[model samples]
Target chain A: MRKLPELNAAGNKIPNRQAICETLMEAAGRDRNVVALCSDSRGSASMTPFFEAFPEQSIEVGIAEQNLVGISAGLAKCGKKPYAFSPACFLSTRSYEQAKIDCAYSDTNVKLIGISGGVSYGALGMSHHSAQDIAAMSAIPNMRVYLPSDRHQTRKLIEALLEDEKCAYVRVGRNPVEDIYSEDDCPFEMDRATILADSEEYDAAIIACGEMVRPAVEAAKLLKNDGIRAAVVDMYCVKPIDREAVLTAARRAKLIVTAEEHAPFGGLGSMVSQIAAAECPRRVINLALPDAPVVTGNSREVFETYGLNAAGIAAAVRGAEEFL
Target chain B: MADHDRTDNVMKDHKMTNSELALLSCRLREQTVDVITGAKTGHIGGDMSVMDILVMLYFRHMNISPANMDDPDRDKFVLSKGHSVESYYTVLAEKGFFDFEAYKNSFSRYGSEFIGHPHNTIPGVEMNSGSLGHGLPVCVGMALAGKMDGAPYRVFTVMGDGELAEGSVWEGAMAAGHYHLDNLCAVVDRNGLQISGRTEDVMSHEPLADRFAAFGWHVIECDGHDMDSLDAAFREAEAFRGMPSVVIAHTVKGCGSSVMEDKAAWHHKVPNAEEAAQIRADLEERKEACRHA
Candidate 1:
């Protein structure tokens, strides 16, 4: 197993979006068919390294998201693996029809990379936040939805997507996140849950995805310190979810708590709840944002305010203890 | 080469004189009505209006056939005004993309491969386009990819004047002109009518040529129903260089039949048996006239 990079002495972590750029550059370097198209978001999407490294493979589509997806579909139709990148907020809503017909319905090999997913845009408010992206993308027929937890998972997800010619919508946060796995977890598989913390017996299970996984893992440790041995599972593959894993957790643990950086409806929570209710009915606590627009603040502040951090998840576990 | 043999094989027997092309257009119109009436679903007015352009592109000019369908350098034709697919499908069948009888038998049937829209599942169909404003951007992508590969293929898309209301059309137009995609050509079936009413009454898209020209495209105008005029416009568009070209072909809604001509009611309205018989007689009469002329 290769060793994972250490956290920065100051900021404490590296942005996962950066790993996407580096890994894509490496992939494009190896395979000439791999291409990347950006909608006037090369800088924000961390695509500069790819643009500079392989100038021929990079495409700039101006600020038109509709054209971006359309052009990528065209490229895919011609037997090229094109990854279209833009802000998640606009890409999901602005060019949705193009994504649906050109990419998904046509069965084109276009990888739609939604950058700055969730509230990673900080105080930019609802317009820039992509809290509703998962619901829209997962609803599409041929689309596979994935949200990687950290840098390690992001690299693996890109590799997996490029290995096949499937339509996928991969959402990545704009900011750096703490590492959930080291070099030992080098190889990763999608549509499968990664169990971070496990025990023979537990009070409950905290299932999280994307950036929320770090805090869920932290909350598990915090709960252990309080004599509550809770299991932490990272459900990164939002669609084609690991139903068996969720059923196992629901059977073993008396309670199931889903955490995500998205709206409480039609997201990780809704998916897990639906599975748990049908297979093994139990009390499922959804730790997610409200239906309305999120309040304006930095991502960390917004997360802390909404009890999405480690302490809040730990507190939710304690709150659910009574139900167990 | 095998590619040369394929193009020659498809074009040899089907290559028609101007009068023969006109006769074939009338035949295609009759077949389109039959399919739509049989399926009980289609956009009849736009299909008749766009039939000449489809025949001109498929049977006459565009270097495409089922033999070279997968060739990377084969010219691409995208039906941006995809709802008018009755005409597009007829032309494709005439060009030997698929058996015309099979298409006629299965169109709009439940679980049949032939759907109402131009799906890529059909051989020789480039992009799946039914929603307006999607075809041009996709053509732009294909054209740009050709440029990147230095391939000699040209990309063409045909849209309706009513489809101009979509803002994405201009966005794609802006990109095509900005990139100076000379290998790309677009045609607008200027039938002057949409589903609701006249294009101008629904939303004024006048100075349409100026609008496209302002976007850095070389614009051309022609009588859409006139085969010679359309041939000249397409020839001029192909000869031009350094910018994308758009040929705005003026046409009447439901061009061939007396009752349907210039009528907006025929937009997506399938003809009943009586009306379908009249349309068939009208096209056959035109075909007989062309046979002598």
Candidate 2:
């Protein structure tokens, strides 16, 4: 893959969604079988480059999400690797039945890409937010769910997904993200978690996925400065989650804190908590959005207000010490 | 001239005449009723309504069989109305795709491959469909795949009139039209009644043919129960090119049985032993009449 644009003059990284377009364009160029289907959100789904580069391989299904998924499943059955891209809210809720029966139960090789997941649409309100996508996607059998932390991970995940044939849902936020990895090549696997921070002894372990991974890694660094020494693990692949990674973190850390930009009930927090409850039984606190509608703001603003940013996570982890 | 006559003879040997096929339809109804009665749970009304259409597809039209099921060049059929699976299963059995006795005995029993809906596990079934509005879209995909591979295989699917109300069906219709999938043929089992009421009373699809035509499909309206009409419609569909085809097969719910025809209660109701016997006698009488006629 070509090198991503240099970080802004300030040296801050750009969003990961662009990496999705870049990687998909490269994939379409390399593999003729790799096709992309969009529901009139080709621009928003960041698939313009792939559309321009490989018009023959991409399908524009207008505004129909159900047909987007059903047709993708059909193409998959016909021996094509299809990625059905739409905003997470509609892709997970409107076409949910098609995703469940056509793609998952029918055992087709369609990859469902839920763009702008987890309040990434920000001011567009709850109607646009996709906080429950992980919940809806995780419940379906034979569906693999993942959320890459940044551009590097997004590139690796897309490459791996194209090579394998299975039903999958990958959620990516709308905007650029802080770089978590310096290079595209990393120790990435479809079913394993990546440990961003390691510690011999830890006061708490922060497990996170998708947009939350950067803040989680930041929290770990801050906790270390405060002498708390929290270990941060990127639980990118949510379904068939790395249970062994959770157990390892739980054994070393005094407390386990699971964070995600999703509902408190399901998603990364819930999956990790379930593993901790049944196997390790540590003091587990899930940092996630509440059941009520999320407050309207930009993604950074919402995240900051809800204790999801680096400072918020560090404080939450430090405060959980009293409970422990 | 001799070679052509020999080829014609071989074709005639494999293809059942319309009269013979009509008689076979009655026998299939008997077996369908037996399986549903044995299971004590199945969609009988729509099954009888769509039985003749299924016979035309599996027995005569579709280029599929147990031996050629795995061949990509073979035609594909999806039972989109999946609830009418009783008739589909019976027809597949009659086609030698599987054993009728084995399927009839184990249907709907815990773990039987012959569950309530048509699934790929069955030898000749293409896609697992019981949910309405799914099969057509999948067939469109298959047909598109055929066009892409430059393979000479056609795709077919059947849906119930009640199932036409689903929004996804229209979405698939729009896509099939936009893509101009000429290799695809869909048949709507227009049996008038749904569980709640008549299809027109429930959701008037009165301009159904026009609707499909507007969506770029070549539409054919025909009597679903008339074996000749269905055969002719499918033949026309096979010959048509440039756009997808949809045969609007108007039918009576529970057509073969005296007590069940046009009744919504029989939509999924299983017949009791007495009613089953009566239906069997009715089919036997129909078979006798066809023999004499």
Candidate 3:
């Protein structure tokens, strides 16, 4: 097993759910046409501020996920920018047909913000966990999927998507996440991959996305200690993936390993395999959740149990060394 | 006369006689039956039931220009009972939205834009609707937009009696009433039969008119096949203000065909070649009778 790097300090003063609500409310305050459609998840989605700020623009569809999406599509058709907020599990699964037809197929300007993504509702069981959203969203044709790494990225992505008149889904975490960047960092672009770390003579590339990016950065530091340089790439946009960056990494590195907190099918790894098979099909190993329901535990416990931490990712990268 | 004056005079005299309009509706019904039989699949019963309603809207009520389909100010018509898209395509083609020949070969060859339901892939269709409950909300949205923009275009949608089972219809109804969309009119094709059986046997919507009235709409009832009654109801719908209107058109399923009329089995059953020929002949006889009347 490869040695893991020291984890980043926890308890950083990051933005909580209330902060996200306040930011959305501020955006609504600035634009009268900005509307938020929620499916009986206003309090959980932290949309009270938005509801108070713009009562007329806020629509509570009351547990009807299909109607939530259809009405948003209708509103978007009439030239209103609507953000449909719901629990990640139901929004991506129950009303999936609506997402495909009303938003993706119709090309409606509706931003689907799936709150409480992944195992954020850890102890609440698998019903609330949303580990399959990325896999589901990546298969859609015109949908742009964004899983922001932290609050700063989330705010920037929200701002950019507000201006973009296309269908998009943003998978946001429930708990406060560590700030990944300073205020001066450039705004998030849909198609570009952010490179957090790089070495001149890296033997392998450890591509990570979403919440897994922080761990991959730590794992890269551990790989350096073992006399192996690992490059870390943050692939945020999973649908229209940054193929150019992926191909460059595949050509330069001896081995490529992808890490995501999602299923192996139709996730970041599956996306990479499609490109690497046609471009550079050498040894591409995918590190993702297995094909089963995730076990019950807290978020950290679940991540550790499923081998999605820094140690697991570093070990997977080292396992690819046999091919090189 | 000068050329321009002659053209203006021809345009002024472009009105159709009642017999001609009846013949057009008969042609629409025959074409609907023909395409459904040709494809070996379609909703024929509902199509026949709503033929006259569609005829009234397309020929007389709606100010649609087949030449310029995307004209923003044109009156909007939505087939809320989307299972009957065969009727819509027939009427639209007869009204010259596309070549009449195109619909004759519909739903057979690959890549043909004419699918079972109304899709935006077809040029003249406004919304891609096949799901029973989607059309009314979308129509409400369009009507609300018209109200907001102060556009003088009326919005009309036809819902089936069975489609009233969907709760989204009531949601749209409440919204339309709340907004006071007087420029909107919804015509319910009360054919009384759905896919399974009679609507009353399946899920009773007996008090449908009262339901719409309680939801704050000006409710009107008429025999759907009576052109005079349909014309009056439409005229009243247009005159009403500050509230949306609902015209509950009582119609028999499969109206023209005697054996199939009011029969639920013909909801989607395609006719054999002999039956198709007989139905065509019967429609032709009806057309001749109307001309004589």
Q: On residues A1-324, what C-alpha lDDT tens digit does candidate 3 reach at each position? A: 122223447765654345556667777788767888788898888887788778877877677676677667766766678889998888898767667766787677888888888888888977888878988886788888987776766777677787789988888777776655546663456677876545554678877777887777777888778877787777877767889878877877788889887877888998888899998875788888777778888767877887788898888877777755
Candidate 3 lDDT:
0.78
Which prediction has more favorable lDDT, 1 or 2? Answer: 1
Please state the CAPRI-style docking class of candidate 1.
medium
Candidate 1 interface RMS: 1.0
Query: Can you give the lDDT of residue A66 in candidate 1?
Result: 96
Candidate 2's C-alpha runs over 4 A off are: A1-14, B1-14
Which candidate should be chosen as best, given DockQ against the real structure? Answer: 1
Candidate 3: Cα lDDT at B261: 88
DockQ of 2: 0.63
Off by over 4 Å in 1: A1-13, B1-14
State the lDDT at B240 in candidate 3: 83
Compared with the true structure, the alpha-carbon lDDT of candidate 2 equals: 0.85
lDDT at position B53, candidate 3: 92
Best by lDDT: 1
Residues B1-293, model 1: lDDT tens digits: 34345345545745687777888999999998889988999999999999999888887778888888878878888999999888898998988889988999899898999999999899878888899999999988888887788777778999999999998898899989998998899999999999898899999998999999999999999999988999899878876889999999999999899869988888879887888888888888888888898
Comparing 2 with 3 on lDDT, the higher-scoring candidate is: 2
